[model samples]
Target: MRKRSIAAGLLTGVGSFVLATAAQAQASAPDTQSDGGAAANSQSEALTAEAGGDIVVTAQKRAERLQDVPVSITAFTGETLARAQIQSATEIARQAPNFRVSVLGNEDQPKFSIRGVSTSDFNLNTASPTGVFYDEVYVASQALGGSSLFDVERIEVLRGPQGTLFGKNTTGGAVSIITRAPSMAADVGGYLNLQAGNNDYFHADGALDVPLVQDRLGVRVAFTASTSKGWIDNVTGRDLSTISSNALRFSAKYQDDADFTATLRIGRSRSNPTNIGPIVNGFGPGGVSSTGVNPRINPLTGQPLGQRQGAYNVIGEIRAYGDNANLTLTKGLGDLTLTSITSVIKGQFLNTVDVDGTNLDALQINFADHSKEYSQDLRLSSDFSGPFDFTAGLYYFKDIADIDTDYFIAGHSFTLAQSYRQTRTSYAAYADATLEFAEGSTLYGGLRYTSDHGRLKRFEVVPTIALQPTLKYNDAKPSGRIGLRQKFTNDIMAYAQFSRGYRSSGFNGGALNSAADITVARPEFLNSYEAGIKSQLFDRKLTLNLSAFHYDYRDQQFINVVTVTSVGLVNAGRSKIDGLEAEVILRPAAGLSINAGLGLLDARYTQLVLNGVDLSGNRMIEAPKSTVNFGLDYTAPIGNGDIAFHVDGTAIGKVFFSAQNNQDQAGALFDLNARLSYKASAGWSVGLWAKNLTNNSVVTGAVSVDAISQFTTMPFPRRYGLEVGFAF
Candidate 1:
């Protein structure tokens, strides 16, 4: 089905080339762009207005066209995201190829997975395989997830392991959120927006920029707040309101006439949202009729699953908060540039959920954590007078965290009250250089050396049992990338790359036994080989990119629930992932644009053992076999204003949420979104947007507590609203 859908999407993209536009259109992009930002160059009006132009990116820490970058990447400009009504990370994934970004218990913690590399366990102690950054500052905690897309800049997604240059070790990939810098051009120029919708929803977000000095200094402030009454019926109250979020940020920039620039930024985000929002679970294991032996009953209340009003007897809530600050300074000397980045982040969250999926008080859980991180980086980049180009950097990082959890089941409660403290000190030096020995060909290579040291201690008490764990370790790892690229023409390029990635090992804080589980899980190793082609065809009206990749893995971290009171990670030994991906963008005419992406993956465990049983050949959790994203946008000049319409959808293939691969745990998802907007020359506009038009009821994710019971969560219900905006 996915194959046929992909083919049909391609056909439509081609057929519309000669039949979509009625007339030429006008551009509706921002008037003045910001500093340290990529400027887009569009070929035409609609393409420029709705689709944006040739995006400039810093995926490799250097400004370059997205298509010219050797790595597989995707970029979303602020204009595109605003038009598409993408407010968060999950929405971005709906359009990105082979990417899936989800949250555990919502709006606070995000699980960002690119291709098939991911960490399935949703624990505060275990870090996500993918890395997330805000303006070059590494966000190291799940508590700091859910970055709001507002106030400025663009978002860049880099696929595949980035073991070099970046501050963190990520086996999957990275998501970079680049905020708009303080603007000196806009003395009083900013934007204000207000939105209202069904479900008693209301939102307000805006930014204000002030020029402190004519050409020397600028200051910017931004904020966003959203609130909505609950959608699902709740027995504990009238209804539960799960969609509540708020954020505030401030930035200042100082530039001198002598080629020196400095920027300071600080932000905070807080949300008191609803959770255990809605759920339905009726079938038993294997999805067969529940026999008396395996009764599908909430033992405490004897209530069957799949309740009509959301199956909750108590109110569940998630409290999340984050604070961050960063300072960036840059100086230019001839053809060489020196940069320094200093950042610190602190975050915490507490989540509560009704675990049993029924209107009974049979089982419930509360999980909470707090974390702090600090890092400093110094780098130098050069575009020499010769054919040689290089960028090198030195980095240092320190991280510490604490955690606690409680579970209540069957008239009894076990409080795994724990205090965990860990400190990570890392020092790394990396360099990447490209030498253009020939006219349109280049030889590229990079090397990174990282020395990581850390210490951890944990004390936990479950009921009357107490467990204490302590450990200390230090290690060094060397990683690098090698690639070759040849420009067949100005509009076409081909490249092949081999890269090695690494992730560190860490101690499992809570344990079944202090002595037996004090040591850390084994570190992970990954090697990837990829080749791809990028082309701008049909007079630059169409952009097509194709890639094939394979990965070899070793000592992978596979987290498993050992018992109700403890969890552990095991080395999955070895595994392999192979995949093919295609991304296409077509500008059928001046006022129409269409994009489609398809991904096919075969991810399997070649060797794995659990409890003396060989679990090899099992499909990886959360890794779908096939995925597709399709979108279309149309714009037309109506009177003195331009009206634009957009529609997009994503389809995911079947996937299991557990290692057991239970048929009952296998499911898929399909979501649709649309927008219509009218913009006039008066710096004012209005729009209507709808997400999940079909209100697709999808089983988003699941987890197994034991052989007899499991927990699950679904996608958010449909959301539609009207928005009004004015530019200052």
Candidate 2:
């Protein structure tokens, strides 16, 4: 009760402060800059003749202003992301609302969840509710998606279910990345960025663009490399938190004629990192023999501890590699256009860790996976001058994966292995249409049909139990959405949307003692409804967006560890989520900006009964009641150079790890990041940055093994660095 009260008070205080500041800015800004009563006609209206307040986005498959889109989205450009010190997708949670990323085996592999709907399952054949895409191509492997965010042009995070346009497994939401295109201009340009930070950290990013064939062909290449020393030094012997990584991307474009254009891109990435340190029984001194609930005390802070430096030691590491290639072709007709997309991805990773988190190596676990996927899409879009417009597309995806797990036990020196191969083939068809019957009002609807076939083979079962050598499953689903939007004024817009989304069913492929537990996992679905309003006040100097949403989810899939090397999925019962979110962007003066977001989520399991026990009314996993984000950016001109400063923070309320709603199964956390920079007149810049400035110990996730052991992971350590960059 004390923790919850403190968290609520802090969030309310911060939100109130930010709102007051925005109100003051609104009262002060003069409305001299004329909008000329001209509002944007489409959602992707790139630029306007007015001030630089409105942003353009392509969230609806067409160009439109942010305020005109019916869905909720938060977009960041390359420059903005860099300035915010956000290099990976996992860091996006610090700036967005109702979004979180949980790191798994290593930093390269992350599980993304939105609005309390996400996955903890690590099966190769299962898909994530939150879809991740690069350059419009879906990347199925979590081990490969993180590298794609490094050289992106823009990232768009859609808040609600984007099932219709995205097609499959997008019941929670979708993250879309658009990479920078190759320029056809007869010019050579590029950039170089280098950094040195605490903990012996070093990083380098470089890019080069060239016009190969004057006005017809062009190429661009970009690469990044980084290394960091371990943060946790094992008292017993070796260190457990080092990192090394490298990634490269090459792109080319051909536009020989006005009607035909094609672009191709290829990327590769590799990383090696020692295992992150885990504390002993994060929920306290509880054990299998004696279940005593005592919070693990941090040796450094003496507070309820998380995973960090400890007396015990273990030896383990992670090696991961990924490669992806994509090609897109577009052809223009008199009043319609045809497009084709081809994509291929391959990922391989090996990770090992000590299960006990103690010097006495009771159990050690190893997991390895190799995956390959191919996809193709064909679509046609009409540019009709009439009141009605539409777009239709067909997509096909194929995936193959091989996975292996090993469990090593001490004392008797016994080893166990669970190996399997999995494959999936999916096909989908979708169409979306819009009708503009009035000048400023529109009605839009979409539908998608998807079919998936999955199989698991070459299984190794428990020594005492007999299991099937092969398993196969097939499933089909239909998902879609409908929405209406109306422009009340030149600066005000309102919208309402309803959607249905689904996740595919598949084989669990676990080496469970019970054959029925590992045989199958059912599909899940969501019925979502949302309403929102977007407005620009004080002559576009202040922008505010507010939304309310409700989700009805059924057949939620839950995973529980059966052993150190294997886990089984359970079809947990129905759940419901109700949430409200608001964002404020205000510019009180030139070169000074402030932004803040508040999210309130209420999620609970409505009906869950197992073993004749009612487990309903429990809080949803990974869902926080209140999440608040606030930030500020200030820039001013000095004598010979300009100085800029930025500071931001994110706070999350209590989050539960399981559906049982045990008091000890929850935690709260916060983080702070800041930077200061100076720019010269010749396109050169230098900056000093800090992350986790307070060095506050916070837990991001925790899981309990029965009533015996609880494992917890923490946020990054305090890191301060100096950086230099040059642009052409």
Candidate 3:
């Protein structure tokens, strides 16, 4: 009955969305930038002359040339992704500067960070320190953060506190994705790509765009499906590694004239049997056993242990899982535009696993999570192109989540069921403008007033704990970017900018244990100062951009691991973080480019009381002091097609993995990825790609109490693949 009700609700919601789309279409105008004219022509030239194109980004809610932006950013075009073999958000982190993504027991709850500042917990109730946006719409849940790379035009990674333009938990940075819009012309073109690699990996993706009504309405649909055999053997013959996923997206647009346009998009993704491998000891050096003993053996049966051989197998065995539904609409209102995105995202994740792999008599555990999110946003901006430009907007979001976990220790069974419902409503009004003061100088300023209210209700069945918490926060922050640019000789420009950002505080659901139902925390604030230079030489064939930035952070929110109690999770203390970063992009030759970025972080606890003693001098956990990223790509013409070679590397400097600031174990690690592609015909191509080419063992985390220490490493071995594709 419950399943049926959910299905009915979904159908009704979609029906309403369709009606809204139709109504908006009737009141909208046409888009003037759809043809292959000035904008398109310029974009094409930019893509060919450089690795991708001279991207135009709305980082400040105003369209500006990417090169002209003084902030530290990494942008990738769809074509660049195809050449680099970057298919997912996790893959993008490997190449982007000062970025790292890691999963914590749950695949759906991954931690994302830039420049060593990140959220340390995987609780659904806590807002992510890093903000993720799709087509200008914010995705509020981590389950929906990983987007399918289909029909996407470009992705922009803005590294820094973007709280002013993005709003909310953007203490670290923001990731923006732009998808391809529908075309009104009758012409149709698409591409089919297939890839096969080691571990029986297979992937396929394609898209189709059709003009339903010539010059008035159009629709575009795309799909991606992939499967990969388990890479690691369980030794017991049980499959321990495997992954399969499928996604579909549809977009429709109607244009009436050059001033009004309406568009709607819906998308869904499903995956069967996702893998979160069992814990293993000796997987790398400095590793420790999670269960208790190493080389876990069956004590009762004297038989070899199965897949669950180690301690604390949080991610046991995958049963089945899927994510569904997203709807978005955009309307042009005369000189202003409004976008409303109503998304009903749902997922079911099940896992059954053996906690202790060595004991023939084992402990079995099962886990499941069901969640939904709804959000609305409205914005207004002027279309005038002059010395001054501006924008304003408002947003609201709500979410309901449920988690069920059962653990069976031999014959005894323990179950933990939690139902969490949270509502967040935010009213924000913001405006930004750029004033041209001289021939090559401009002034920018922005102001925002945001009021937020939230309520959380949580119920835990196992321990019989019911907790309710409510919060009200209001802040009026005025952020201005005063940048001065001087044209040294018409081809070179020097600039400097200063901006301030903030992130509000809220309840920490993960910290709600039996002993403590609530923990009071404060908001985090950041002030950034930066200076840079942008220059073009050799008749625009060579481009170089350099920037240096320093960030001052206060009242940073962090999670502290505490002993589990009957009531709920507990918090240890609070901390502060500050850092500096440098980025450089150089295009010394046409069709050849090199991008390098370096970050230096000094993060420590301002006040940590452990054992009734203040430990304010301790360093932050999992935050490396130094990190670097480098990329080199080269392409050459070969018969009607092109041959390209690309290489990229990421290096992380040594740092303490725990707040204790221990230096007994520290090491620097690096990873290298390379790819080569060749065109076989006018519409066909083939490529070979390899990742983790050196198979270097890198420790991502460690735990230590007193003198005993335990370490965890990802150790993703070398993987290689071959891909073939055709376009027409």
TM-score per prediction, in order, is 0.89, 0.90, 0.82
For every model in order, what is the number of clashing pairs?
Answer: 1, 8, 17
| Candidate 2 weakest lDDT stretch, 10 residues | 36-45
Candidates ranked by lDDT: 2, 1, 3
Which sections of candidate 2 miss by over 4 Å?
A: 1-51, 282-307, 311-313, 462-467, 562-566, 663-666
Best by lDDT: 2
lDDT of 3 by residue, 41-84 (tens): 11111122232235565566545566665566778877777777
Q: Evaluate model 1: give its lDDT.
A: 0.72
Candidate 1 residues 173-268, lDDT tens each?
A: 888888877677746789999999988889898999889896789988999888888766564454653678899999898889877888888999
Q: Residue 140 of model 3: what lDDT?
A: 66
For candidate 2, report its TM-score: 0.90
Better of 2 and 3 by TM-score: 2
Task: Kindly report which residue stretches of model 1 are placed more than 4 angstroms away from their true locations once superposed.
Answer: 1-52, 236-238, 278-308, 412-414, 463-469, 509-519, 663-666
TM-score, candidate 1, is 0.89
Residue 239 displacement in candidate 2 (angstroms): 1.3
